[model samples]
Target chain A: MTGTSFIFWIVALLTVGSAAGVVFSKNLIYSAIALLFSLLGVAGLYVFLWADFIAVTQILIYVGGILVLIIFGIMLTHRITNVQLSHSSIQRGVGGVIVLVIFAGLSAMILNAPWHRSPAIEPLETVREIGRMLMINYLLPFEVASILLLAALMGAALLSRKTD
Target chain B: MVDLNTYLIIGAILFSLGMFGVITRRNGVAVLMGVELILNAANVNFVAFARFGGMDLTGHVFSLFVIILAAAEAAVALAIILNIFNNLGTVNIDEANQLKQ
Candidate 1:
């Protein structure tokens, strides 16, 4: 096996295993911690896909920003004085069965689809092209996303206020 | 790394795991984590297609938008969860069923 494929396998295992830890861990804190590594692994995958900007964004927004928010949510809501903040689960038997079936179908479709393969051109840099597209083709959506983010910021502050 | 199907299959596994977490976890926060997992899975697929299908960075742009939306969604969802916990006294989603009669 090539070194690239070997690295992919290692990263994939870390991602999938950490994801499992997030879902299966009884301790909420442990799950949150595991989510950190899982997000990092995904960023590594993004690098392999030649999306360095996206990979950096993923790490910045997900690990740095959102993960902190999640941990804060976990800590603020639950009193530390109480018994450990291990969470509970319900209907695992049914959920697992359904997820299994869905995964099987997705795998089959992905493998069987006759995807068109073009002669791959190794684009050395994608950020400039992506930035240009965002300005020209995606100008409207870019503006809209900024607006949405502004609204979300205000809404979160409003909703999480100390006073009613 | 080279095979698109491998990345897609990894995404499928992630999506399935996230779905299972969504359906089974009692804590609202845990449910949100599951949702994040699902979103990551989709982003992986998007980037993979962009690379393998010769989509000329369009997939990267779309994934950026998705990331923005996800950030917004997480903020709103977490705020709502906090509200639920404050008014209802718990983050356990199952117990917040006031409409269940």
Candidate 2:
């Protein structure tokens, strides 16, 4: 196997394993910490796909911002050490069966689909291209996203405020 | 080199796992985490297709939007979870069934 393929295997394993931990771990804090590693692994996958800009954004927005928010949520709502924040499964057996079937079906479909393949290009510096596209073809959505973020921020502040 | 099929397969597994988490877990926060996993799985597909299908920056742009939307959704969802906790005294979805009875 080539070095690239080896690296891909390693990264994919880390990503999937940590993601499983995020779902299966008993403690909420452990799940959140697992999510941190999972996000980091996804960022590494983005790099493999030559999306350095998106990778950085993934780390920044997910690990740096959202994870902190989740931790804060845990702290504010539950006892720091004594509370058992593990989630109980309601219909775990059925859920597992369904999940396995879906995974099988999706794997079959992906493997069988006649996906069009183009010649692989060398990874280019995409940050500049992304910035240009944001200002040009995607200008409207760009502005809309900023507006959405602003609205969400204000709405969250409003929702979580202490009511007198 | 790893094939596109490999990446696609990984995405599928992640998406299914996330779906399972959403279906079985009772904690509202865990449910939100599951939702985030699902979104990330979709983002993986977007990026993979963009690279292998000869598309330009469309997939990347879509993934960027997905990331922003996930952040916004998480904020709102967490705030809602906090409200639920404050009013109901727990984050378990099964326990917050005031409307069921």
Candidate 3:
């Protein structure tokens, strides 16, 4: 195995393991911490894919912004230190079976699909290109996304305000 | 060189794990975390495809938009969850069934 493949395996394992921790941990705080690791691992994977711009954005937006928001949400709404939020399973047997079946199907489809692979694997400098495209080709969507974020901010602030 | 299948399989597993978490966990925040996992899984697929299948930057742009959407969705969802906690005194979805009555 080459060095890139080895790095891929390490990052993938870290991501999946931490994601499992996020899922199975009974404590909400522990889950949030695990989610931090998982998001970091994903950022690492994005680097592996040569998406430096997206990798930085992933770290900036996800790790910096969303994870902090989630942690704050956990802290603000409940008893922080003493709260042992039980991750009670509603239908464990059924859920496990359904998940396994969906995974099997997805894996089968992915493996069987004839994906077109490009032979030339040149290291791409994507940051400038992504920025240019966002302003040029994707200008409409970019503007729309900003509007959506603004709306979401207002809605969230409105919803979480204390009502007397 | 790591094959494309490797990334695809990883995405599939992550999606499945997210699905399991969403189905089984009762806590509203945990379920939201699961939904984030699912979104990450889709982002992985999009980036991997853009890297391997075509040299286009469309998938990368799409993933960026998805990340923004996930952030917005998380904010709104968490705010709603907090509202539920305030009104219902709990974040369990099964117990927060005022509409079912």
Candidate 4:
């Protein structure tokens, strides 16, 4: 009916559709490409939520950083001459049945929950606010995350070292 | 106008699909992709609740942390997968399990 909802519908469809592509595609390369679109669609949802900064970060870290890393993993692991990158799946029947049950339960809970919601919508200075909070209220976690990043960096390098 | 329920439902779908991918995919990298999807779904729900539940910017900060942690996790996980591929010659989880023999 309105512009935002219309945009929301389009984004939601794009996200879900591309996510399906990621799950169902037999080709690993195609799944990676589909994941790119799905990540972009999610950024669009963040836009609708007025989380402009997070949307940008999602594109940066997810699309720019993580997706590239995944692509490299795919390329490095496989012999890339014919590019016949087949990603085989297993136990589909059991997985499908389990997912369906979980989804049904989640949908029912979401639909029935008497959520106490407040529509106090205001455009946020998300970047500035988050920056200040990181330095002040969340200083401990901020420092910890940085340390974690450092540890992860070193650990990854160590794990991927040449065995020779 | 878009509401909280809408986001929650979408998150549910993404989460379920991600779960299915994780369950059925044998390739290690594909499984990582599924994990990314599940993380994205949680990030969406966090942002939505922050916006609509009167929490202001808390959810943004939380999702930022999630993003940071996800980056770290992906880096480490991919490194492990590459090592697995190097030693085992395949990234299939089912195949790499018989390491004791």
- What does TM-score give for chain A of every model? 0.96, 0.95, 0.93, 0.96
Expressed as tens digits, the lDDT of each residue in A32-126 for candidate 2 is: 99989988999999999989999999999999988888888878778777677776778999999999999999999999999998976855778
In model 1, which runs have C-alpha deviations exceeding 4 angstroms?
Answer: none
- Tens digits of per-residue lDDT, candidate 4, A67-116, equal 99999999999998948799889999999999999999999999999987
Best-fitting candidate, measured by DockQ? 4
For candidate 2, what's the RMSD? 1.1
DockQ values per model: 0.86, 0.80, 0.81, 0.89
Instruction: Tell me which residue pairs clash in candidate 3.
Output: none
Q: Which stretches of candidate 3 lie over 4 Å from their true place?
A: A81-83
Clashes of 1: 0
Clashing pairs in 1: none
> In candidate 3, what are the lDDT values of residues A43-79, reduced to their tens digit?
9988888788889999999999999999888777677
Per-residue lDDT value at B78 in model 1: 92
Docking quality tier of candidate 2?
Answer: high
Q: TM-scores across all candidates? A: 0.97, 0.97, 0.96, 0.97
lDDT of each prediction vs. the true structure?
0.93, 0.90, 0.89, 0.94
In model 4 chain B, which range of ten residues has the least summed lDDT?
B92-101
Expressed as tens digits, the lDDT of each residue in A87-150 for candidate 1 is: 9999999999999999999989999999976656877888899999999999999999999999
Sliding window of 10 residues with minimal summed lDDT for model 3 chain A: A119-128
